[model samples]
Target: MLLSRLTGVSVLGLALLLGACSSTPEKEKVAEQPAAELYKESQIRMEDGNYRSAIAHLEALLSRYPFGPHADQAQLDLISAYYASADNPAALASIDRFIRLNPTHKDIDYALYMRGLVNEDEDRNYFQELFRIDRSDRDPHNIREAFGDYERLLREYPGSKYAPDAALRMTALKNRLARYEVQVAEYYYARDAFVASLGRGKYVLEYMPDTPEVERALELMALCYEELGMEKAQQDTLRVLKLNYPDNEMVLTVGS
Candidate 1:
């Protein structure tokens, strides 16, 4: 009787081990899934907002079948998945890779647009959002890169469906850049660095004309000129400011 009981326990343990081996973890099973199936699974995960899982599946599909029917779509979806997961670096890398490898891909314009968005969001500060802090004075390197990306999209893909939206974003980016210059001018002026302040103010007027910040730039230049004791230059700046913004407080107080 004892021998028979031991034999039954051993057989049960063997079956349990086999079951564990056959039931591979879902993530591990990704490697064995067919390319089309993997892509479909990724799409499902993406729809469900499971970006991390989608990323894994898309990446697997791309690796296993680089030249498969779904390769192109997988790459594009991977970029989106990375972005949705807040993985900016990975998103950028994937975008650059797509642009380089498939320059003539019908979806190239979409890749460019995604690249611009990733760069634009790269510098987004949670603190700024939470506190409503103005970030116009912050370093705008990423912002400039994003602006250039959109500019290239407009220049190269003029008729792309993304052109209209890109144009709008470009306008906003230009204004932000203009505001950055204005902030720098204000910083210099506060430190009594009138010459530097004047130079930055001129930059906005010359290169960033038509922006909403132009008036502020003009007022700042007028103040810089006044501080530097350049009466004629100050008068000229005030004349322009008054002509454009007659009701401006600076025009009222200083021009008067």
Candidate 2:
């Protein structure tokens, strides 16, 4: 009986040792791999749309080979992986770090383009579209940031391959920002807050003058002026609206 108890104790000790050995975690084991192999694996994962795995591999590669020949590309790939996984903060951080570290790199323009693209796509997601929340009332902060990013890209790299697309995106973002102002104006008008509506309308006109929302902004300003008993301002806005948008639907409403 004494020998059997001793044997049981020995088996238990062996079992515990094995359990501890096996519990080291799969990721730690992977960390032992070479950076080149890890980076190549990350590229494959990214191509397969396995962004989480790609991010993991790229992070491992960067940790292992901070100054490797593939370091810059790895950092750029990590940014794209983060963006693909909807990890905007991580993507932004990665892009910023790359730009800071390699300001004069040949691919710096691509980094700037990705920065703008990241901001541009940040507010465009499946859930937002599904709920229709973005179309009606969007936070203009992201749009404005994206616009600024694109502007910087164009200013710094005027002949960049991405300049054309960046320009197009800026135009769309401008309209969206103008539309946000229009939405705010409409909300104020609905609440009988004519002064606030006028302020928002004037902002849209001053900042986003050539946008389609300008007509609505002008109409809102005129209505607010009429509501506030400012007949001179109302007449002046109506004249400008009539001059710019001869067939404006709001012309009839403001005319009366």
Q: Which one wins on lDDT?
A: 1
- Judged by whole-model lDDT over C-alpha atoms, candidate 2 comes out at 0.83
Please, what is the whole-model Cα lDDT of each candidate in the order they appear?
A: 0.86, 0.83
Where model 1 places Cα greater than 4 Å from the true spot, the runs are 1-29
Q: Model 1: per-residue lDDT, tens digit, 17-136?
A: 568658544653465788889998999999998887999899889889999999999999999988887778999999999999999999999998888888888867644554579888
lDDT of 2 by residue, 8-90 (tens): 33556767756865753344234567878998899898889877788889888888889998888899889888877667798
Tell me model 1's lDDT, rounded to 2 decimals: 0.86
Determine which window of 10 residues in candidate 1 has minimal summed lDDT.
1-10
How large an RMSD does model 1 have? 14.2
